[model samples]
Target: MSTDPASTDPASTDLVSTDPASTEPAPADRARGFEAKPGAIGSPPQHYGNPLHEQRLLAEGTAVVDLSDRAVLTVTGPDRLSWIDSLTSQAVAKLQPGESAETLLLDPAGRLEYAVRLLDDGVSTWLLLEATEGAALHTWLDRMRFMLRVEVADRSAEFATIGTLGSPSLAPAAPNGIALHWRDPWSAVVTGGHQYSTAQRHPSADWTYSELLIDRAALPEAAALPAAGTLALEALRIAAWRPRRATEVDERTIPHELDWLRSAVHLSKGCYRGQETVAKVHNLGHPPRRLVLLHLDGSEGVLPVHGDIVLAGDKEVGSITSAALHYELGPIALAVVKRSVDPALDLVVTAGDPAIQIAAAQEVIVPPDAGAEANVPRLPRLGAVRR
Candidate 1:
């Protein structure tokens, strides 16, 4: 699909600029950096509770997160169902009211452009994607419309997306036994006592007490709202072992490499651009690497940044992609380690403090027909061989 670079907002650009104020300061400025500004990279205001830590707290308690960084696209038309199903990996045509699915929009080369959560509100389907790739996803969908009887528009400015986390007692109950209500990633149950509407536009109109919206000029005020930043969110994801599009994926990464096939890919779906490669990798080949979670020995020093190597003595087994300190779990990280490594083996993060420690990541099992093979990489022997 053809993308117009001019369509993006200036503030949303991912490229680090040369502006003195924007550039990361030197090592001498490390201590002062946190004190410098509230919104600096790796440093958000304390009110937000460190984006890395907030995600964990949100899971344990009630928290409202500003997901304005996600881009929204609205598709409406008589043929919208067919149009979307032909492009994505999920069965979009069959999505019932109030249901959502995570799907991928792939490039011609089978690489991912953006992974999105699609919410179907009966009338129109909303595609929520990473804020950084919003414009690109919009343009790609628009260009693919060609002669299809569907209309796709970027509605990012018109609607705001916020994430709410809490217990069944804290969130409003869902109607009609539809226990799963899509606010974003987490599901909410609308209680029988309250007459709730699943309409996105009327989110505030019906859910009086438990609703929030995060926009450019507007921030919702609620008792459940936690003051957290990106770092806290990263930490929580690490604890849950949830992967993000940026830290866990790139052009070289495939869906199975990060175990995305579990949620994002549908094996039974009809042919799509990247279906062949996905099938080949699943049935005939193993993912070159695998994603794993690491518990760092924080007492050693600071955690390493993304792409830092993981070592088994002199051998590089993997690289750390995401890391954060959890209030409960301590310094933890997510890494794409070599499948060859034994999950029980101890390893070391080669960045930050030399004394940092990492244990084998816990693995979540995938379904048999999903195409993952049993012939995974084995970890090297650390001690004396018996035979």
Candidate 2:
């Protein structure tokens, strides 16, 4: 996905959408006094008039955010687990029913192609992903199943994703006999995964975000719950240092750059596409770029947008991949910058036409030497070696 700045118009394809074939608005879109988000990559409401209050309610697990624009795909057959395990970054060959796992699809070079949130209910494995990725991912998976028993199908029209900070009162849809709820794994390192952030206490330690899948027809019931909006969700997401594929990924992105190995990549997993590069970067070298959090100076009362240039003094060091105005944190952003950029340097983001610079305070998420986890011993200089 482009990760470009988006518009607030509800009908704009640049943000969010339901089924393209359905001309009618989604049930959630008809909520009382819904205000669509202009800059969201998917078409979800920005808020219900009181964004900050919504954020507080959401953080307290008293509110639900509509994520109907996210796509749902299903893979089934006896060969499903092993088949997908061999093709993606996660180790899912033995995934238990109702367990959640994240994975990535990469090119041979290990650059991100797609990011998927997976849940298996025994009979079928459900893949939840960005709406823009639905068709392409489904097509790719189908084509790759040349002789495998696995079958792939797009089920977005039948189900919708609803976001919450933690367990909500709303029941998940069980079209397949098992309730579908995807708990995010960002709060801690999963087994076989690695963490690159040096923070003594990770922000995601408090991130209880999860997605509940529901039948499309049940959206009105979901909307009737104490509801927040995508804007509220985005603010909390940024504050948690979560890496979302739709806004955080780009053409050159690799797992190491964003410290995605913490949840999405299995370092010791069996052979899979991009494993070589994943291994090489983690065990031998540092990623060229590192993800960071920027606490923007909100004195100007302006918030930056996606693709805004990040500057370290006069030199361009990075670009803001995601930005939001948090209820507690004020204006903040997630940016990917050159690993060499001094984390101590004050940064600036240039946003809007006839651009104005917004001062940013840097907070490192991925350190400069994030990889080389193997601790390979350095060889002594030939002449300095003791005889």
Candidate 3:
């Protein structure tokens, strides 16, 4: 359905004027947020702007994101904190009122199930995740609650979560400091608290990265806020190198492989499902792959697609998971490279119309005693263990 700007704001000059029937579809449906230009692959509808461009802007300036596509769940009761802490990767029990953390739900094998942002709002806790998995995650969490006093309810339909990308000064104010910065790329600011199924349209309202909870009755008012489609959101995500559940991770992907352990996994927290795998991988074995940032030499051609092979010399070292023509960084991407691949070596993505050149990611090193030395076996030379 076409969005009505007048229904949202009588004073918005930024609204694009068009006749619903006469508006020919652009190469990409700039309205819904898809990158489906004539020859491009179909993508989710757009939200605010190009999510990738928004992410780049967020890094250099500020941008708003519509996270309505993200699903929300509410857990209430005195035991909410303790109950949730027993399930996810973060130390949810230690979070004070108004605090938030980024956490993960893992499968039995320690592979990722859902990555979420947990917000403690004094009386209840909110879990925000990608909308695609909201229902399943809610059911999973509900089933896991055996004797805990907490009540789990899927609030996805009730709340519309928005995301803002930029520094704190540009973000909306929260009485309890900027809604807790759980990871570098994410923050959670409660919009409607426990208010269920509300909607409202606010002309002056900026729905960028802020989650706005409105009752269904308030949808007209909520639509008043600048509406964004999904394409813009995707662009923003790629720019930040932020990985989502379905696009970047799958059933066999571990938290460490996605750099999630740095932000989502609490190294000192008590046990939870898959904790043993986390501990074993972190303490004993080297993760098979590592997520890295790629600066594609745009001079070649368009960006590559997911699963595109990354080559170093003639050896395959990694595969690209996400790529975009970043407004600021040219063609940039995120890739999962073999942990054994030398960081100094130059790589190339073999996917785009013309191969895109890739540079090694900036390596973040660990202190000497962080854990046992990584156990990636060295490649044997012609006849010796030496290169």
User: What is the overall TM-score of model 1 with all chains considered together?
Assistant: 0.69
lDDT of each: 0.54, 0.83, 0.55
Best by lDDT: 2
Give the residue spans of candidate 2 off by over 4 A: 1-42, 380-387
How would you encode candidate 2's per-residue C-alpha lDDT over 1-387 as one tens digit per residue? 111122112112222211221233323443732233222324666666666778899999999988887788999999999999999999999999999999999999999999999999999999999878898999999999989899999888778889999678889988678889999998999999999999999999989999999877777677678988677788899999999888889999999999899999988889999999999999999999999998876655567777889998899999988877676766678999999999888888898666888888888999998998789898898789576
If the candidates were sorted by their TM-score against the true structure, best first, what order would they fall in? 2, 1, 3
* Cα lDDT tens digits for candidate 1, 168-284: 232322323333235433222221111112224321222211122233233323223443444545555565556678677766776766666655677667887787777777766
Error of 1 at 60 (Å): 2.9
Error of 2 at 86 (Å): 0.4
Local error of candidate 2 at 54, Å?
0.9
Write model 3 residue lDDT over 283-303, tens digit each, in one string: 676577776667655433455
lDDT score for candidate 1 against the true structure: 0.54
Stretches of model 3 off by over 4 angstroms after superposition? 1-62, 166-241, 352-387
